[model samples]
Target: MSKEENAIIARKLSKRFPRKVFPRLEYFDVLRDVSFSIKKGERVALIGSNGSGKTTLLKTMATIYLPDSGDLLINGYDVYKHAEKIASHTTLISPALDFQKKLTLRQTLRFFHSIQAPYGELDIALDFLKRMHMEYLLDKRLESFSEGQKAITRIAIGMMKNPDIFFLDEITTGLDVNRKEDLVDFLKENISSEQTIVMVDHDPLIVERICDSYILLSRGVVVKQGRAKDIGKELAYKYEVMVIMKDRPEFDEIVMLFPDQADDVLIDGHVVYFRAEDEDELYSIIERLRLNRETITKYVVSLVDLSNIYHALKPETINEIRTVEDEKGLPERTPTFDELQEIIRLFGIMIDTKSGVKIPPRKLP
Candidate 1:
């Protein structure tokens, strides 16, 4: 392919990390001969389970780490040989704690501008702050800002430089619903036809919403690459429906409202239905049911339901479903306790990785 046609290109790019404690410890392969090309103006999402090399690939594209083998080029600039030139046109928003705590938002931005452009281009910085709804917090010390505030500030700083390629590593962490929506709006508005964006997030929901394309990584390899909408459609075939109830009151009410549907309901678990149209109708029904101020706490329509998808997609994942014959000899399995725990954990991880929901670690007895 022509160099001018590609925004970023990786040809068999790979990375290896040496182990710390032994004379001959095995080198960990963080990335393995991954090759893909991103086009200008395309919004691509890199998704995987933890340790699947999404961050490593992004860092390599950002020229933070040189590939152990193969080649990576950003806008025709060799990532290894043209690190400085690539740095000029690429920006990476990592999770590293690098901001100055003592400096206020405005002061910090000014400092970054001095280093990045140095020619007095504070207008873009100011505009970004304004777009983030963070202009009012400009004078507040970075140390005093909340996690969400810090995240927004970092994003604003990254955008100020107007890099040709933007690599976002879960940049929406710690943001509230309103702030998240605002940031998404800003991204949609400012993304130019000449710029490229690559994002990594565990939550497919967020990825599906923002990205036009997706690359699914598993065990340091690209397992699937295609349009995001196509992947969603494939996942929908295997997903089970979930009806969440807050307590016994809501559960009882749900049963009373739809007795026939209740028979298939797994009570706090997910149910599989073959028809997408029925699922849509069920979602609407649930919403209307909640409109009456009924004691319904929460209702959700999951496309693939995380647990089922994880097990179906990842060979390493353990399946919890056991086949049993019903009264008519139809086979089914009740979702087990372990399955519920895994599903909840997977959901939490996806949310935290995508939105920075800091869930505390589970306590072990």
Candidate 2:
């Protein structure tokens, strides 16, 4: 690929921090010989446990933290030598960003515009504020804004730059569900095929929604890197499908028909449950069930999501995504879009949960 097509390139990158105490200076290695590349227009996620050097790597790429050794390039430009060229096309938004506490959001935007010359006019910045739903807070000082508002303002400022490359680190941490959804929608609508985005986020839902590929880091080492679906398969997210038929004989008939495809099949009265390795296999089974529409009454299916992948990859740190509990302490449930798609793809097997006609066995005249 051409140099412009290569958004980021890191070769044997390493970084170390020096600690001084009394008469001695000691060095601690944060990243060691890390190497990776991200193509332009690819939304790549940087994932790892805390202190795994995810943030350190991002900062180094953005030139906030210089690597002690090795070459780092943005659009084929040497990070140290062509830093200004890199900055012209890139914007970094991190929770660690410090702003002038005394300045209002409007003043901050003006100052940033003066320094970076992001937009020739203030109108663009105002438009971004409106998009972020923060136009009302434009006059509010940074000290008066809540943590979430501050994050929104920072994101607004970053968006105003119209960057070709976005380097984001924990930018969604303080956002509520509504604001998060809005941000996700905004990204989906605005992030075009010409832009490159690198994000560091702990929320798997956000990562799965925004990133097309992932670079998994463990203890400053590259552990895995690939497309999202391949990574999902490598993690082995299985699906369990259960079909309830109008009669027990239909369940037995299905078991007899696809004994090879269905294993560990169990029959509880008129219900049958089977497992599939992945969605492809599940789709095949659902096709067969559709052919046997006369027998099936209702069905339910469950599969793994991004959260499951996170659990399998970082069981030590990731927490389970739990549905809220009712007053009686029973968990409530709602299907995510991914889960709903799986359900609808396999929705053929499900006749209806209540009061639906079952097509009787075909009669050859």
Which ranges of candidate 1 are over 4 A from the true structure? 118-121, 232-242, 246-365
What is the Å distance of residue 189 in model 2 from its true position? 1.0
For model 2, how does the per-residue alpha-carbon lDDT over 118-190 read when each residue is reduced to its tens digit? Answer: 4434665687567768898878889988888889878877777777789999889899998888889888787
Which 10 consecutive positions of candidate 2 have the poorest summed lDDT? 356-365
User: Candidates' TM-scores?
Assistant: 0.70, 0.69
For candidate 1, give the lDDT: 0.65
lDDT of each: 0.65, 0.70
What local lDDT score does residue 251 receive in model 2, on the 0 to 100 scale?
43
Q: Which 10-residue span in candidate 1 carries the lowest summed lDDT? A: 356-365
Q: What TM-score does candidate 2 get on C-alpha atoms?
A: 0.69
